[model samples]
Structures are given as structure tokens and as C-alpha cells.
Target: MPDSHLHEPRDSTLVDLHQDLPDAARLKRLGVVIAVGAVIIAGAGIAWRSHSVGTETVTAHAAAVSDVAVVHPAPAAPTDDLVLPGQVQAWNSAAINARTNGYVRSWLADIGDHVHTGQPLAVLDAPEVDQALAQAEADYQTALANRSLAATTATRWTQLLTQDAVSKQETDEKQGDLAAKTAVANAALANVKRLRAMQGFERVLAPFDGVVTARAAQIGALVVTGNLNAQPLFTVADVHRMRIYVHVPQTYSAMLHPGIVASLDLPEYPGRTFSATLVRTAGAVDVQSGSVLVELQSDNTDRQLKPGAFTQVHFHAAGSVGTMTLPGTAILYGNDGPSIAVVGADGKVTVRLVKIIRDDGNVVRVTGALNTGDAVIDSPPDAIHNGQNVHVTQVLPAVTAAKAGARAK
Candidate 1:
């Protein structure tokens, strides 16, 4: 221990002597340099420690943060309406036609002309019918003259028979002649009446009260009987009311019943609707389309609704009692099937499957394992998964022109 202490002192002594004389001035300058060097070393260590602490703080802050879309929960009870589109048509329609074979001498009506029942629609020039009538009339006249002469001769013969001037056979012959003449006269009268009735076919009359919607024949044009090469001279439609026919998908066929209330809409009158009533069904389903034909009736007393105009029909079905409606914009279309994200209480995202009953244009009615006030991501996420950990913030309402606004308020 003493030797160790002596070695330490000898080093001190050499240092003290070196610091004392001749080199004292040099020692003073050296002392100042050594103090300054110590100061620079201490400052460097302090600065390095401060810089390290700052770097650690910045890293911790970055790790705690993330950029994500946020959303809020909705109520469990949902009540949304479902809407669908449809078209309109006429209730009663018929193609007015010519019943007799003749030429159209004059058209008394045109398109949009409203006519009453039995109104003369057109005049037909039946030259052949006229000639036939003339022949029949001349034959009737000759028959009448012959019948008159036979009756006078039979009267004279009967008087002679009463005086026993003629035999029984002769008398019988005279009586037969009178009877034959009377039958001929009666036949002539029948013939004349039949000919007159046939001539009446030259006039075209409206079967019912309606507007003429089509005109195919002009004056001097040949019109044929039956549905042959000759088309109908005109098409008449009763525009006082209209019918809307729709082919509803077979899935909804069961829900439909006759006499159900419905509505009609025209694109020309956006956002407006006309009430209608379900009259009947086509009774059979279409094989190719898998749809059922539904007929609805509408009143058009003002004549505002025209036949052949395309219009939409809204079938007011009996909505589910406790159903909920969701904005379609919030529903996400995905590859594995449709799904929506729900942020759990633990800040983790969980996806859920939904059953869609009907898909209209804007809103949808759905049934799923979700409730009101449950924050669900409006749109499906990209590369996002079910049961994933997440940090959620309130996001803007989907498809709305708004910044982040609290929906709870």
C-alpha cells in the first residue's frame, strides 16, 4: 500500500515541479489551454444528449398517429322508403276499319278528331254494290207486274168454275196459279228490302266515342274487307283514361294483389306523381323473362295523358313493419360480395354481411346484424379487412357537400 502511495506522489511531484519555475509561464498558458479544452468537452456532451432526447420525442409522436377515414354510428331501427319506376298506356284502344269492300270516296274525320258513337267516319263509293242493287230492283218490279196479271186471270177463272163452265181439274189449276203469283209478289218485296240493307254498308261509322289517332286511307283509295292487305282506316283511342302496364319481376309477383293502390309518373313532369289502381294481372307468367304482367288504371279526364307515351308506375307495396332503410351511397360493392365496416368499441373495424330485399335507385331496404348509432364506414374500404385494429375520427356524410360535421347534434 505504501509503495502504491509513493508511486502516486512521485507523479504528483513531477507535475508540481514542472508547473513551478522557468516553465511556470509555459505552465500558466498550458493550464489555461487545459481548462478551455475541458469546457469544450463538457459542452459537446450536453449538446449531444439534448439532440438525442429531441429525436426520441419526435419518433414517439409519429408512431401514435395515422391518417384514416372516420365515421359515426347510426340507430338500430331503420325506416327508409323504397321507390321503383314504371310506364303508362291507354285503357281502351281499337283500330277503326271498313266493313265492306269499296273505295273511300271521302274521309269525314282525321287524326285527333273526336267523334261520338255511330258518327259517320267516312263515305265509301261502292259502284259494284250499286249495280247489284239496280238489277235486284228491276227484277222485283217485273215480278210485281207478273203477279198482278196472274191474280186477275185467276179471279175470272174462279167465276167460271162457280157456274160449272170449267172442270174440277181446271179450277184447281187456276187456284194454284193465284197462290204462286202471291208468293212471287212476297218474294219481290223481300228482295227489294235485302238490296236496300246491302246498300247501307257504304257508310263508315264510329263504333264508340273516341279520338281518331291514326288515318291510313285517303279519298279514292280502295279498302278491302277483313284484315287482308288493307289496314284499318283509322285507330281510335278512348283518352278519357289510361292504363299502365308493367312487367314486374317474378320475385315480387307474390306481393301483388288486384285492387292495390299505385302511382304513375312521367319524365316530363319530374317529381310529380299520379295515383292509380291495380285492376288485374295477366294471369300467366312470362317464360322467357320470368316476370308477371301487372295492369294499373289511371284517370285522365283532362286528356293530359296520351296513349303510347312512356310513363313510370309506382307500385305502393305493403312495406315491412319494422324495416330500416340505408343510403345506397354508403353500401360498398366488393369482389367477395357486399360488406360494410363497423368500428367496434375497441377501435377495431369489423365487417358485416347484409340481405338486400329491394334495390331502387337511391335508397335500399336491408336486413343485417347492425343497429342505430353504430358507426359504419359509408363506402367499402380498399385493402381494409374485417376485425382489423383502427383509429377512427368522424368523417363527412357520404356524397354530401359538407366538411366534417357532427351528426349527433
Candidate 2:
């Protein structure tokens, strides 16, 4: 019933549709392939994301680590010059005080005057002492006259007793009176001698060959005898030699002994050094200061150095075998005390408590649990803690040039 061309076209269209249609078995195979591909892509994506996250975590951890510079502890020199503050004093100094009550009439010697032993420094006018001496002398003379009269009387009485004109008791009494008068005369003479001795103190004399460093007495000044609080009339000091008093630390006290020579540096005399010899020591440590007092003698024949001058004393002290040196920057002061941060082999920080024996400007001498091989952190961070991880960025020399310079100074 249809046209032949139309029927042919419809049959062709049906054939095309049948060819385009896929079988169930083929579709099943395609579905399995697609599923396998999706699983592979998802696994790859997950693995890539995990790798990126791991890389970021590693970078962040590395950034959180602290970088520090480390240094090794250096062995101290076998012998080093230990410099300490000291005071220069006179070899023989004296504070001249009055021995007798008097008024200062005149001063023969004053400050900066060189005097000889037994030389008069001042003259005291003691009217009371003079009056007393005159009285004592008059008393002595009266006693002598009494003794003479008594002797004459006793001789006459003895002669009369021989003649039997006076009784024996009367003669004995006369002899006793003569003896008593003689005793009184002796006592008066003793009093006169004591007064004369006291009068000799009117002249203030020098005790030794020295220079008058101070003069407190003035003309018309009243001086009291045996006054503990009275100012000295004069201060004399022997400057031919000087004595240096240095308070050496107890740790270095053992190095100080008699005959050891030291050098002194005074601020007044810059760039000049004076030689001194150790003469004595306190032989005991001062508990309050933890130091030992040492005496050193130096020649001042030139009289350039003065008493009571501050100086720097350089003592050649032998270092202990266990002593160690480190840069001051390595020291860490905390609430506990002075300490040092040390880096271990495992890149961990360990704080060691230390005691500072000496602190130079840039260097320090210390003793503690640290060893020569320890790696100490220089300029440690304030927040640095014990047992913390750190990255050592650099290793510094144990003794830097700056530290050496400081030690030399």
C-alpha cells in the first residue's frame, strides 16, 4: 500500500537503529572498564593530596626550630695576670696625738714638711704643767731642808745621849724623825722627777723620719691628754717605701706568698707601672667579703707615689687545672642564677648552672658542670629553656680575638 522509495527508506532507518544499539554483554564490559579507571584516578588524587600535606608539615616544623650559634669552652691559661683594685699606703704611718694637756703655742712642721726622728713638730704652752712643776720643785726643796734639820737634830740628840743628858727613848725618837724626813724627801724628789717628765711632752716630737701629711693643731687650739676622740695633731708617713693593700679573692689567694712580685698601675700616673713585692697576708679568708688581705711593699724613693692613692694591682696567678674560660655573651642570667646554655649531640639545649670566678669585659672565667668539649650558645635567647630542640647555625671559636684582647687588658 505504500510507495516503493518510502518503504526502502524506512527499512534503511531500522537497519541503522539496530546497528547503533549496543548488546548487554558489551555494556557490562564497558561499565567494568569505567569503574576501574575511576578507582585508579581517585587513588592517585588521594596520594597526591597526602604528599602535598606532608611536604607543608615538614616545612612548618623546620621553620619552628630556633637557630643558635655555639661555642666550645676554652681551657684557661696556666698562668694569668689577675688584676685587682688596691690602695697605696705608707710603709710606716703614725697619727701623732698629744700626751699632755696643753694649748698649741706654735707648729714647727706642717703638712708636706719632711721631719727627722725626735725633731720637734709643735710646741705646746701648758701653764698648768709649769706651775705644777714649780710647786713640785719647791716641795722637794722644803723636804730637803726638813731632812737636813732632822739630821742635825738627830746627831745632837745622839751626842747628848752619849753624855746621858737625854733619855734613850728621846734619842730613838729623834732618829725615827730623821728617817721619816728622809723618806719624805725621797718622795718629794720622785714627785719632782715625775713632773719634769710630764713637762717634756710640751714639745711634740717626730717618732720617725717621715713627712707630715696632716696638721690638725692650730695656734691657740686646746688639746686634751688621753682623749680617744681627739683629732691627731699631726700625721706623719714614711714615703721612702709604700705598702699596697690588695684584697685578693679567696680562689686566687693561694697564689699570693711572700717574695712574689706584682705591678701596680695608678690612675694619676697613666701608662706607668710600679713594681711591688708581697710582704705578708692575712692568712685567713674574710667571711663577709670572701677575700684575703695581702700586703705588698714598693719603693717610693722618688716620692712620686702618694699614700691613700687607689691603684690596680696585677698579680701573676697560676690557673687551676679545672678552670675554664668562656665568652661573657655565653652566660645566661636567670632567676635560678648564672648559667650557660649548652647544645648536646642530639641538638638539644641543656642549661648548666655555673659560678663566675672572674668577669672580664668580654670574657669570663667560670667553674661548673661544663667541660672543655661543651658547645655553649652565645647570646642565648631569653625564652630558651632546658631540654629544648635547637638548630646550631654556626660554631664559634672558644677564644675569640676580642676575648683575647680583653684578657690582655
Candidate 3:
């Protein structure tokens, strides 16, 4: 009421109020737009950072798992020995039989008795031979007496013919009779000599220095003159040296030769080994066994080893020739022959063909286009193929791999 001018007009007051309301509303809308823009920008930056980190982590993991473990091929070494089965036999063997027919005589030598050449083994008493010799001697004496009488008669007949006391025809007849008697005496002497020779064979003798392995002679056993269809009186074997017969497979035939040194193992003497030498070969392949018959001579001076016994022969072959060796686990058998997995310098896998020279149950000797430094894969995964990338984990020594192969069995 005191200041009517200060109160102002109502329309002016209303206009000011409306302008203030519009300004307030515009300020609120601007604040909302700024807040929305900030939220969108923050979300975009977080999403970009997460994507980059995930991509980097994925790339690192792929690179780390790309390599495979591998091993180097073992170099071939010398001094490898091979063991094979063999049979032992006597170096020299013989069967002694009776030469003349007679009753069984007492044997001087028995089984396990050592005898020298021409030593008496047995003596046979032949009653029939004695009687035959007596008869032949008597006939020879009678023939000798007749020949003497005929000679005297022929001399008298010749003298009479000279004195003309008898005819020429009669003298000729006397001479013919004397000649016939002389021929009879010569035949009788020959028969006596033949009988004497047969009598000398009653004593059976040893043919060589050896031990008697068998004895069939007895006090009452009958002895046969001929060897046909007759059992031997004694079996002798010269065991100073033993013969080892080994039927080596054809694959190892080339390693056998005269003078090759070897060792023998016998079941009778466990842990004992005897020295031997490869003496000879059968020179031909056995069609049935597809093997070569090799003869090895071993010294048996102590007579501890016997013939027909089984033995194992050890043969030392050139390890250098057989050289490259690998674990059996690394080998693969196929129609193209044996193969192995080898890794190249480029971190890729390669399949290589190899020849197995010898198989010693656990490890095998191989010959191939691989070097000693070649990195070979051990226990390769079936999923691995040629030219596949691998990560090298460990390289094992050849000896270690060989041991592993044995354990795998």
C-alpha cells in the first residue's frame, strides 16, 4: 500500500515468471544430455580394451602349443654281441663192431674208459675158426707128402726112359701126375694162409684215441663177422674238442666265417662260458629251415661238456656295420618296410623308411637315410601327420631310449 509504483504491473510479473521456468527446464535437459554422452563414451572405451587384451592372450596361447617333443637318433656303436642257439656234438666219433663171427668175449674197455688207437677193446674166442685152421693145416701136410712122392716117381720114370727101360708114353704120363700133385699142394697152402688171416681178427681194437660212450659187448653175446644188420660192440667219441652246430638264419649267414671267435653257454654249467671258433659252414642253405649250418669248435680238454647237449653261442658282429639303433616303440611296420618319425629343422614331422638290421627284443639296429644328429620323435601321436608343426619338449639319449623300449615290453 505504501509503494504502489514498486509493485509493478501484473503482465510484467507473469512474463518474467514464464522466462525463468523455460530457462530452468533447458538447464535440466542439458545436464541430462551430458550425463548420457559420458556413459556411452566410458562403455565404448572399456569394450575396446577388453577385446584387445583377449586377442593378445589367444595369439600367445596358440604360439606356445605349436611345438612337440622329439629325440635324436642314436648312433651305431661297435662291440655288440649276438646270442644264438646251437647244438654240441663230438669232434670225432666212431662205432666199433666185431669183425669176425664168434662167441661174445670179455671186453677190456667199458663205457667212459679212455683208449688209444689200436688198443684192445675186447677178445672173442672162436671155436669154429680154430677147427677150420686145424683142418686146413692137416690138408696142407698131406698134400706136401704126396707132392714129394710124385717128384721121386717122375725122376725114376725119366731115368728109365733114358735107359730104354720104359716107353716114351709111360714116361710122359708119370711127369703129368707129378705136376698135378704139385698144383694140389700149392692150393692147400693157399687155403691155410686164408684161414690164418681170418683167425687174426678175433681181437677187437680201438680205431682212435677216444672215450667209450657205449658198450654192447658181454660174456655170452654173439659177435658178427660183417657189420651189416649188426649192433656195434662199442661207441667211441674223441671229445677233446666239441663241435657246435648252429643253424643260423639266412640273414646272419654273412657274419659267419672260419676263425670267427665265439663263446658257448651250456645249460649243464650255468654262468659258465667256453671259448669257441667258427670252423666251417655247410656251404649250402637248408631248404627246409631256410638257414645255414655253421660248425663251431670248442675246446673240451676237461671233458666237462658232452655231445648232443644244447648250447648257446655268442657271436660278436661288427656293430659299426649294424650301426644305427632305435627304440622299438619308434618303429612302424608297413608294406613298404619299417619306418620312423623324424622331425626336420623347420619344426615339421617327416616319415622316413628304415631297414632293420637286427632285432634284440628291445632295441633294433637300423640302416636308413637318417644321421646320428637327426631329431626323431618318440611315441609320436597318431594325430601327427607329415609336415605338421610340433613343439620340441625333450631330447633323450639313444641309450635312454633303448632302456625305455625294454621297459615298454
How well does candidate 1 score on lDDT at residue 338? 55
Best by TM-score: 2
**Candidate 2 worst ten-residue window by lDDT:** 9-18
What is the Cα-based lDDT of residue 303 in candidate 3? 95
Pairs in clash, predicted candidate 3? 67-390, 67-391, 68-390, 68-391, 69-393, 76-323
lDDT of 1 by residue, 17-65 (tens): 4335676677787799899999999999999999999999998766544
Which parts of model 3 have CA positions greater than 4 angstroms off? 1-71, 135-194, 225-230, 328-343, 346-355, 375-409
lDDT per residue for candidate 2 within 1-409, as digits (tens), equals: 8778655545433334334456886677668989999999999999999999999999988976789999898877777787899999998999999888999999999899999999999999999989999999999999999999999999999999999999999999999999999999999999999988889999999999999999998999999988888999999999999999999888677667888778999998899999998899999999999999999999998998899999999987666677788888999898998999999999989988998766665788888998888999999998888888899989998874346776777
Which is better, 1 or 3, measured by TM-score? 3
Candidate-wise lDDT, in order: 0.71, 0.89, 0.82
Ranking by TM-score: 2, 3, 1
The deviation in Å at residue 196 for candidate 3 is 3.6
The sequence of per-residue lDDT tens digits that candidate 3 reaches over residues 1-409 is 5888657766533334234467778788678989999999999999999999999999986774455556566766665566789988898999888767898778899999999999999888888888999999999999999999999999999999999999999999889999999999999999999888778778888989999999988987888666688778999999999999999887677666788889988888999899998989998899999999999888899998897899889987666463677776677776778788888878778888898776665677788888788887877765556787777878876753347446777
CA error at residue 87 for candidate 3, angstroms: 2.7
RMSD of each: 15.5, 9.7, 13.9
